[model samples]
Target: MMNICIKTVLLIFLSQIPVCFSYAEFKTDCSVPQSLNTKMILFSVDEEYSLYSPEVIGLIEFHFKEKSFINNVIQSQYVFPGNYDYQVIDKDLAIISIKEVVGNLVSKYQILLVCISDIQGYFIYSLEHGERMPNVHRDTGLYILR
Candidate 1:
């Protein structure tokens, strides 16, 4: 009778061993990818400006071609009434200059390379003073900035 009891306990423990391993494996798989995405979001903010010009805000978007990652298209837009100018530094970098007229004071806000992408094609926001911003994902290889 003691032999039978010991066999039963051993069988139960052995059966649970696989369950524990499977649970641990599943947890690691899910956690690894989730943590990577979170880190990407946290590292995306490149700058934070406490005293930013309130006159004009710029909106920019980058569209990456499918399969041909080297070829990208850029589109720029402005929020509020202002004279804006932009220059593409490269495929993934740009400089935006905004001129706002407020009460005879012409304020020029230079937003340099507000966003950039990695070699693996991940988009990150370039913020001032390492400010944290909302996580933004690409839509069909298009990244939009506001």
Candidate 2:
């Protein structure tokens, strides 16, 4: 009798697990990497102010169940509204470095890069214009060493 009761209880517990989550399938819309130096930023529109910037951060590795891969968190940064920074002319890029992380073993990702593009957005407030001005946007690439 005890054995029958235990089995019945265990069966009930296992069955309840499915009702906990109704979703049957899990899917991700992000694209996977196909080649070197050619990664499509997940959401270009949403990547303006990412902390990773272009150069300072590269070789970004994501920790999956057992493996990891590189990814770009910040596609662009260092821009002013009225005066956008153009790389061809300015020759400066933002480089992102990962100082540290609390959980290194779990996600072991350390970012270290320097922006080679000219410092465009590093500006002081203008006395004549209180409103934020426009800065040019230039295509910048992150450099990661092997």
Candidate 3:
């Protein structure tokens, strides 16, 4: 009975070893590329492209040219001008810090993008406090490389 109990305990402890190391920590800072021309479309929560009728919230485009960063956000038929800074955490992962300026209002966002391939990726955006949109929450979206 003593040996059986010890073996059972050991089995339980070993079963948890993989769970502790399976999660990958998100990279914070690294050398990121300065050239970007990517367009991504944001979908409302609970929707994906496979639904055949995903509800799109907005479309965003990022451009880095001539040492300048240019960003465009289109929502509700209005285009907002913006700029961003980015850091590459890995060869296929990046964090984009953006500030969108609209007349007298400014909104901030931090985006985490994981590139699955050259033409497609997944992303999530966190909206900073004091945004122009009152009921807005954190949104996730997909990247369509341009």
**lDDT for each residue of candidate 3 in 71-102, tens digit (9 for 90 to 100):** 55555455555777667777678887777776
87 in model 2: Cα distance from truth in Å? 28
Task: Score each candidate by Cα lDDT.
Answer: 0.31, 0.26, 0.57
Query: Which scores higher on TM-score, 1 or 3?
Result: 3
Worst 10 residues of 1 by lDDT: 29-38
Q: What would the TM-scores of all predictions be? A: 0.29, 0.18, 0.57
| Candidate 1 segments whose C-alpha is farther than 4 A from its true place | 1-80, 114-143
Residue pairs clashing, model 3: none
Candidate 3 regions exceeding 4 Å error are 1-34, 37-58, 64-75, 133-136
Residue range 53-138, candidate 1, lDDT tens digits: 22122233322122111111122232223344555654445444445454554544444442333322223222232112222111
Model 3, residue 100: C-alpha shift (Å):
1.3
Query: Judged by TM-score relative to the true structure, which candidate is superior, 1 or 2?
Result: 1
The TM-score obtained by model 3 is 0.57
Displacement of residue 19 (Cα, Å) in model 1 is 46
Query: Clashes in each model (backbone N, CA, C under 3 Å)?
Result: 6, 30, 0
